[model samples]
Target: MGVFGALNAAVSGLSAQAFALENISGNIANAATVGYKRLDTSFSDLVGGGKGAQPGQIAGTVSANSRATNGLQGDLQQSQVDTYMGINGGGYFVVQGKAGEVDGRTIFSGNDLYTRRGDFEVDKEGRLVNGAGYYLMGQPIDPVTKNVSGSVPQIITIDNSVIPAVTTDRIRYEGNLPTTPQTSNQLGGGDELLDATLTKASTGAAPDAAAAGQTVGVDAINAADEVAFLNTSIAGEAITVYNSSGTPVNVQMRWAKTFEDNGTQPDTWSLYYLSDSAATGANPKWTKVSDAQFDSSAGNGGQMLVPANDAMTITGLAVDGEVVGDMTLDFGTGALTQFSDSNGSAKISKLTQNGYPSGDLAGISISEAGRLVASYSNGRTRELHEISLVSFSGEAWLERVDGGAFEVTPESGEPIAGAQGRIVGKRLESSNTDIADEFSKLIVTQQAYSANTRIVSSGDQMLQEAINMIR
Candidate 1:
């Protein structure tokens, strides 16, 4: 080749090799960088006329070129992307600036932008921002307080309905009131009834319990199952005990309804005393409650609101806020529990009023189509929101921005809306560069660099030979 031609060849070789080396170094440096693509070098032949000096000969800058190849990605790939513990899809997340937050940017509605990195978290201000602090985009919802802010984080609201359990079943006390020593067990729960009243320590009055000629005796009542309780003569009826003054001081209510009316009481109800007792006028000791007390609205008897949820017995005072006795009826939840003798007779004293079973939070996972799900304590996982993925034909076409984000370029061709990539949850898609590939390209580029150096040397020798003209 002529001296000028040889020199031109050497110059082009050096330029190509330098460019290839630079690209190789860039690949190696970004080996750990996420979403980094690998680059490759290309070579071709160039020739002048004169039959092109042999078809295979190379010349000038036509020798080689370098570029990146397509990795054939962007299908529905479910990779465990961990940047955002909640992201379940491979899509570009959008963000908008809230007035002074950025240059006045917003995700969906504001100056919309695109991003691939999914590592996202909530900030102190409850902003759904990315790892680089770029805010993610979303709409507003007012669930509880019914307040909405332009820039608020998103959270799923759980629907917790509270319906309490109540006590059901009647308390039955049959036959004429007998003298003290009454022993019966004919109720759902085993409990003893106290026919006698004692003088309150605070009050020296009540005609004095022991002074009324009222003899005290130890009488007991026990719990019985539903079947055995049915067999008992005094079953299904509740009891009532008035103070020595004949005032209905305490009573064990029975019967619970199971039908719920959205936190409202049901219509139609009645109260039955399993062991109803009345003081005989023949006894001058305890004050006798006249028949008027039993039939009058304000007389000596217990009142109860029937719950439609369960047939068990509940307290009447609970419906009103005036609860009494050692037992506490939880009518708010609508659960019913009652005291009973072994023979099914309603025993007034032994009812348990409070105890409930509670349900654990499980774990977190992602869906194939990009859904963030949170497992609940009740073995339930709810779909928070569908994940969205954004893809552009050419990434380099994106304009580099401050947030490790990209500004759309005309060439990137508006993100193709799709979510067909394999999305792996709880995992991250590390940088795409392969060390072996980078090193191999580095070796090749290095050799090309050396060969270019040799061409420059050879050109210099040829120039010397032609210029010296010693021959």
Candidate 2:
């Protein structure tokens, strides 16, 4: 072998060794880098330069022996961008492209692309655009109503312009009015005022004319009796009502309407009571009663319920409404005319027409099926939007274009759209980098480089010996 030519062979071996070491150093430096893949360096040796080819010609010229890792597997590793979904068991979220060059026209029909990364968010446009601005494609919207009738591949938020719902537009009430017509108070001026100081009779004491010691006409007595110098005032007619159980459940009836006689019974409302003063809850339960509805007897000055001849129609003696129809109350067996006694004056407790207003926006929650719920401020919640999520069979085929978005390839197959997955708020996925594994690969590379250096040294010694023998 030629003297300088032999040295060239050693140079090739040392050069390969250097390249391997450099590759390993790079791996060590990027060990902490997310989704980084370690690389293995390959070397080639010239095999033909041993002696001359013919007798006197070189028996070996530099033929090449190549050995290396093509880095295809490394490329596969690098594809893993580290962001991992919570579950390795299955599936991942697919995001769509944003407004880009080709997508600037927005003609792609909101196609889906795959990813292992689950870090996502919604943008101002109400699209479920992740932090990368990639949209979570939802159901196809009905451009007009925005309701998803058919399958949707995306999840777009349709702002439900708040249309006020009915809170409390109506209510029913019933109660007893403690009205004592015999009391001293009068509508204008009354005889009861004058009888306050009079020493009257036991049964009929006329308040206006105490000397006429008997109660006359329909007026009540402000009975004043001072027997043997004893003085006491007795009240006039007073009225009250109670349930069948005799336990007084104070009824507060809102005025449904008032009426006048024009042969057409005048029906008009004067007041309304929204709820019972005692009842407090989201949906309070009320005692149901049809037979023993409240009304007053003809002679008694109290609230009572009497049955009617016809079974269906019962005279509703609403305590608050002005018009008291020729109604009846039924205690199952019999019926009686309701509140037919005393003056036409039936005490009415004010009724309220619903006291609540429109609801306000409260909180928002999601379901696994991608149902959006908007809670109202009035303690009422409603189902708002049904969000959709899309997936693909071959995620590796997904090409990340920009904005954390991906474009689907034919290799990715068709999009599998669904809406059963719900998002977890206030959380994120992290990169999938493995630092320890990368460092370990770097050490192996370093050892390989050292062994290659010794190989070069031994080859140099052999060439030197051959050259010395020729000298």
Candidate 3:
């Protein structure tokens, strides 16, 4: 019985060593696989007649079990692909498997999986698919509000359709206006000289200009008036704003010093935009958009005093019949200043508009915030989806699946949102398997397997000796 037990133990030992060898070989084989987690072998001793009344018994057999290294992280490699992503700390990307296609749409398996593999790219159907054919899941974002929509993640599908045009609704302006502008009027001679009396209609107070029948047109449409107005006003920053029909219109601006502080009246200036380039008669050419009052007092200095809110609405601003709708011109607090300039021109530090023409999808990229950002051919970018990352309480207990993905097991608790790991854009995680470590295990497994065979041979010799004695 002892010999038989010894033989059984030897056979189990061989089986255990073979199991370890298989795991070692697998690890070595996947050393180059992206996001591959190494598999380790664990051994357990099985005892046969140990606790019986007959007495103590030695260990009878060995059992092998697989251990997971899913908690371990691999080195990150820089990738030229913009969508290639890598996790830095502790988390996996939530992905879904495609079961089939129905009605020109992909049918999902409904079972969520987790993986560190992020070699994803936009497929022909505009869906983000990884190299393993898994679909990346994320929360959709509202393009207008720029806010993520829901907590639950859905399969991410990019909208490759052309984005419609956005009319200019806001223009952020920041600049320093010169106290004494070197307008063409100030620098030109004779007929080119500008007449200050032909400026915008203004009351004693700067804010009263609009209320005082601002109807008095300050547009210089005639030849003499046009030359005079151009000479009197200094050029301000100009930007191209989009209209409703996706038409690009160049909005040319100018600043003219309307009123200098005469004790009672404060220093005031009028803002104008070229309304019509081909106005032949009294039709308006340059139209006054707003008035800016400056506090030129010694105590207050030269800050914007009027339009106290620092913003003005340009109602129905149009250029050459292209209506740009209404846009708010915001000059943030302290954004506008009146200072002495050698060039006597407005120094625009920031001038941007919140509008874009119709655009087609150009490219897509992953952001540091774990959001999928899409770029457009119209020089516009929009956040499409917020990438979802999930973590588990027992990462090592996850069930291994094909393509380096892991399925949830009973031991691996339900997936939790907001993982500790962050998404690294344009990078990939290499396999955690170490060739050297696998080679060392291989050598040990081979030796152990050979020793088990020797034990079997010894057991055979003992049985043969017993049989010869019987003979």
> Whose TM-score is higher: candidate 1's or candidate 2's?
1
lDDT of 1 by residue, 23-102 (tens): 78876886664444456677665664454447645454546565543232222223444325322334556654444534
- Looking at candidate 1, the ten consecutive residues that score lowest on lDDT are 287-296
In terms of lDDT, model 2 sits at 0.38
Per residue, candidate 2 scores C-alpha lDDT tens digits across 420-463 of: 23343333433332457546655775675566466567767887
What is the alpha-carbon lDDT for the whole of candidate 3?
Answer: 0.85
Alpha carbon lDDT of each predicted model: 0.42, 0.38, 0.85
Q: Candidate 1 — which residues are off by over 4 angstroms?
A: 42-58, 63-91, 95-111, 138-369, 372-385, 393-404
Give the lDDT of residue 271 in candidate 2: 22
Order by lDDT, highest first: 3, 1, 2
> Whose lDDT is higher: candidate 1's or candidate 3's?
3
Candidates in order, TM-scores: namely 0.48, 0.41, 0.88
Angstrom error of the Cα, residue 274, model 1: value is 17
Please provide, for model 3 over 88-207, each residue's C-alpha lDDT reduced to its tens digit, 9 standing for 90 to 100: 999999999999998988899999999999999988888888889899999999987989998999999999889999888999999999888887656754222235456333212232
Show model 2 residue runs off by greater than 4 Å. Answer: 1-89, 100-111, 140-148, 158-160, 167-357, 360-363, 396-407, 418-426, 445-471
Task: Return the lDDT, model 3, position 206.
Answer: 32
